[model samples]
Target: MALGLKIVLTFCLSFSTLFPKPIVCLDPGHGTKNARHGCVDEAKVVLAVALELKEQLKQNGFEVVLTHNRLGQDLKAKNPDQDNQKRAQIANRAKAFLFLRIHTDSPSGVSAIYYPQTHPNRPLAQESQKAACLIWRQIKTVLPKTLPQGGVLPESRTKIGAQNGDLLVGSKYSRVPVVTIELVPMSKIGRDWIFQKKNQRLLAQKITQGICDYLYSQH
Candidate 1:
């Protein structure tokens, strides 16, 4: 190699080492069994949003991975236990900077973010809470008029918990910072609005902005 070319390659390698690409793992909640209300399929909608968010993140120079690619597939697991395990494994193996699980709730106009109440990985849980708060604030700012007045919640705040009192399967198993974003209280009117293609795109854009804001703030 020419002397000048070698110097340039060395600098590029050093820069890559100093600032590795950030990998984000996205889990779109539910699958085929999860019922659809009106014209909205919860699984399908979340997956759509996830796909858009993935692209947005990529454009921002972050590496993004989805737990599952399609609507019917459930992370190649036979049961829920295996499903969650597989999801967590994907993030853990990727050494993801963040894990975001997207979900939507019914009876309209509600939105909230959640973090694990307590976990063996306490530091990770704390980080999750911090990210959740940041993302919640951003979402509230963007959808103040449309979503319900909800705040970031810890898993312990709710009575109904996921396996082993974790409140969410992916949250329980994840070793990385993780949060679940639930767009909820979907009243009849809210459902109609959410199913619109334009609205879906807008929602995706807001979420991408929030994630970018959170990541940038950390650095």
Candidate 2:
């Protein structure tokens, strides 16, 4: 009996070791109250993106979670300056394979943000950089109309960096790989442009495909 119990315990442990959990967290930047480009709100747009990302990731066999739901709560208690502590929590808890914070660019262009390796971030930072590059490349390919600003960058050079905010907040606080993808310029798009429901779905699909490609490449 004792031998059988030992064998059973060992088998369970070995099985767990062989199959590490897969976790992905999504954070939609800003809130519904925050206005973007006078037409659409950051809260609404980002939430849409996050939902789409969750569904797509599910289809690809990932255990996904969202840091912030539609409800409002303090996202930045530990790090008051950056409203991304919620993102950090998700990263810390799940040891997430990827924690993607979705936001929209301003000034009529598209860009992505991640903490550079030269900064406090190191090897984990490199993963984020790679993910950002993959996402940017895929976005550029799918949406030729959107401008390809660049890859993981210092805050100073980025639109988020130029402004006084925590664009790099999640990366700074995150323990696992993290990346922020700026889909498009909400303010730059005119009413005549691609704000239709079909276009939104297309953009979401492109972004989802980009992130999934990055995740698969890692395996």
Candidate 3:
């Protein structure tokens, strides 16, 4: 009996060592109360994609959490800024290994990924960029022909004077590596593709694959 128990313990330890679980926090950009643009509801689309991504990540052995689960439910905050801060707080509280914000741009024609360019937390900023690059590579692989001109860009890479000096509110406050993925723009073609249920699922799968790759690389 003692010998059998020792063998069981050894096997369990080996299994854990081979497959470490990491927590991932996914934030779907907007809620119903937030801004809306173009034909499809941006909030709904992102949420749908996030939910799908969550499932895919789980299947890949990641523990996933979402900032918000329902439509029209903004973080319990007074304004958009506060709302974003609360979102970051959720991820920070989770101690997530990675945080991804999913959003879409208007007047669509491009897809982009972004990381904080100016944050007080230097380590977090660097990790965020690394995460962004990994995810961007996956996205580019999946949507080679659709990527925008500049591809993955830092927040500060915008036109000099026009830059938003601070990091995105959620990213600035996050304690974990963070990246925001702006899906193809709302251009006619973008709308046509993104609005399709099948394409959204495919996008989620590709994003999840990239995330899994990044996490595994860290190990």
- Supply the TM-score for candidate 3: 0.83
What lDDT score goes with residue 124 in model 3? 82
lDDT of each: 0.71, 0.61, 0.74
How many pairs of residues in model 1 come into backbone collision?
10
lDDT of 3 at 65: 86
Query: lDDT by residue for model 3 over 1-219, one digit each (tens)?
Result: 245334433443354457666788999887834423323577888888999888877765678889888888746677776787888998999999998999877663468888886777888888888888877776676553654545778876533213446577777678888888888777776767777888898888778766755664565
RMSD, model 2, all Cα superposed? 9.6
Worst 10 residues of 2 by lDDT: 31-40
- Error at 189, model 1, angstroms: 2.6
Which candidate leads the pack in lDDT? 3
| Residue runs of model 1 more than 4 Å from their true location after superposition | 1-18, 32-40, 144-146, 158-163
Q: List the residue pairs that clash in candidate 2.
A: 155-161
Q: Give the TM-score of candidate 2.
A: 0.73
- The positional error of residue 181 in candidate 1, measured at the CA in angstroms, is 0.5
